[model samples]
Target: NTAPRPWGRNSRNEVVVPFCYLDEETRKSVRDDIILAHNHWLRSLGGTASKDSGHGIKFWEAVNKKGDPEYCTLGPGKSWNDNVAINTVVIRHLANTNKLSAPIGMAHEHQRPDRDDYVRYICKELKDFDAAFERAKRADSRMTEDALCNKPGQAKLYGFRGEDYLMGVTASALALYWPVNKVNAYDYDSIMHYPTLSGDAKEECLTNEQRCHLVRWKDPGNPNDRSVAMVKENLTPSKADIDWVKATYPW
Candidate 1:
């Protein structure tokens, strides 16, 4: 699906499409667009900031809180990548999806919406999530890497692309991990407790239409049992060798 570029930096790199899905021209065009966009952002931010921050050290920074970026003519991630420009980079997952890393959700639409404030908001949010994750990591290591860069799951607070940070870790040996077991129209415990799927725990109590959404992807338990009935029985998380989630947690 084609998505309209927002008023800010283009997040094309975040798309899940593989190389096969995009031609070389399309990729190049996207990259070029990113560069052009980045440069514009930089120029708009009062040029650059070059200061000798230390012995044999040079700190060159061009920031605009409204739409700060690492390099304006370089590409689309300036707001989130530049020093405290918009959001802080927290790899939602490893380069792959299993693990998780995402830009810490630190931007306040109002406070950071202005050009100057954008930089400050990004900086603040970066500091906020980094500190938050670091602190929580002491108790649970996963909390450090696999957490929303924002206020946990606060993406629900406002309707935006804040949750784009999610990437899949090593794909579950889906065939082996999640397989259809049984479809319950009104069974939340079955779907939620299956250890392989995600659905309303109280789905069994829903009507036909409502129950249909009570999807549950469960571990196949046995890879060889990839039968249609078996998959259909499982329902929401079908075992039809498609869209299966690996049962193993990347951690």
Candidate 2:
């Protein structure tokens, strides 16, 4: 599914991305959010410099002769014409759960092989970090600090919610799908990154007492220890995000 599709570019060298909603209802529900998200990207690419500017490439929405945004239908034997299809079912689920900003579908453009490795690395690291924490708790039942804080290969493990483990996995999988270096380090503020409190649409942890039960501390033995939210939800692209896009799709 991560395979690259050859989309056409306009005379201006802007990538023309054709897209459609699964149905009318889905269109009505997410049309605004979709447009907002796309416009954010467009502005960033256009270098408008109004809180969302950085990329050096451009993107154009596929339009008909009337100049209206085209919404094509996807079906069996139907030619997508290099169009990117958005599934309504998934969109509705995200909308209902208040995680509309979380990236999904074709937005992740990394090679499948690399994606698999990244996912495995993140999952294993988290699991090992949790396991080490448990071991330390079993030995000392009253520690007030994270035992794995300074441990090699385990420094990134912070106190994250037990229920949000999947979010961590997803965040890792959807992270900037490109080679990262100190100059282009991991962007914790990228629009693709999910906030710590994301996916909790029902506000399961509304109170201190409720939050206590929902969050998992690295040092379970410490009553004062607290869980940290991994990342904050970013509705717009960051400078690093634009840099990555420009690098990937240079003109």
Candidate 3:
């Protein structure tokens, strides 16, 4: 789901996020990293610490469900309703399970990646756009189409599905779920952004040429040729990311 959780306030007026682990042992592996990462955003809002009195967000260990040792009940109390209780955050090890397929370091809001489904979505958006553009190009004069693709402003519309449509979909989802305002430019440095090399083992391409085949754009002068831009992994949230959270849940 792309909707934001209806988080409840704690005694300190901080938004309480009730976290649970499918494998309780996993908690030990990720606790420090999670706290440190969250602290970055908390500190940006002028909070002294992540869970201190001045902080706007607090992480609480969810109470375990009755008779179920593996899974813990979501929300603050016995009821599943978040509005009446606390917001829930569940974490699972994606590597250990065959039930869901996701990239090693990838974090999706909901739904795991299915190979066929992923290809279909990418083709539906990117290939459909290309097909439509090709039809439009055929209807117009060859020189007209060439000139349009060669223009700096129009070139972005011609051959960059990965940079444009794919990234646009992700950005739209983030804006819909998060408290961030819509932005014209995509933030490549956002921690939520996927790296250029991100994919399953089967999806990994050995060379840049092979990788560019998946998503590439034409340059202003090189209308017929295509180029790929590498997106490095963002280890932490960007300044814009921190600002969005601070604005949404101010201390």
Candidate 4:
């Protein structure tokens, strides 16, 4: 667990650490990726990669106040100011598996202090889609409300009532420290998922990521860790997750 945890250092010279547990490799990868991404962003700024607009350097310097205030990553052992910090990032690790997960952590979209706004927006959008679909129904096809979302193993609309909710609770706590907008759908199969917690599985649970209830039955691994919830596995984002991203952050 000595892996370097990198986060977006803000103008205030601080970062929102997820305090998440990740294996050595994934953690390192994330740290490296952040640096690379930030560097890439810097190179793209002022229009040319070759010319260090000093913007990239300045940006990282402010965000990366971890290791050295002056040198950024070029300073010494662990360079804290190495990249452009992205907000609302969620760092996650699995409990007891060799699952190869990505370095980028995810932010919980459901528990944004603005949670209600997202729900309203998504619900309205869905209703609008429902109406549009009805108008375009094929001459020989009959579309039912269930048909719109009742796939073999998916939730009807946005998992309005299920494990997505439970996992969201965990994300909420983690997100309090991060700067994020709350208009995202829940990700059941994410590293950020509660290890042993989930929403109402019976209502709208995916076969692979469903759970029966939303209680903290046991502490993760630390007996003294009185925390009620836990994360179980490494859940890579699914197609549904991608759809959520598109909906929330429209390109």
Q: Number of the top candidate by TM-score?
A: 3
Candidate 3 — which residues are off by over 4 angstroms? Answer: 1-6, 28-36, 39-55, 63-87, 94-181, 201-206, 209-225
Each prediction's TM-score against the native? 0.18, 0.46, 0.49, 0.25
Q: How close is candidate 2 to the true structure, as a TM-score?
A: 0.46
Expressed as tens digits, the lDDT of each residue in 18-48 for candidate 4 is 2221223445556545445444433333322
- lDDT tens digits, residues 170-193, model 3? 222132312232342344555554
5-73 per-residue lDDT for model 1 (tens digits): 112212321212111102223334454443443343223222332221111111123445674323322
**Candidate 4 residue spans exceeding 4 A from truth:** 1-72, 77-106, 109-187, 197-231
The residue-level lDDT of candidate 4 at 171 comes to: 25
Model 3: which ten-residue window has the lowest total lDDT? 96-105
* Candidate 2 per-residue lDDT over residues 40-135, each given as its tens digit: 776666753222343223333445577654444443335443343442112331232123223222232111222222221122233234565675
Off-target runs (Cα >4 Å) in candidate 2 are 5-8, 48-184, 200-230
Task: Tell me how candidate 4 scores on lDDT.
Answer: 0.33
Instruction: Give the Cα error of residue 130 in candidate 3, in Å.
Output: 20
lDDT of each: 0.24, 0.40, 0.40, 0.33
Q: Provide the RMSD of all predictions against the true structure, rounded to 1 decimal.
A: 22.0, 11.7, 12.2, 19.5
Better of 1 and 3 by TM-score: 3
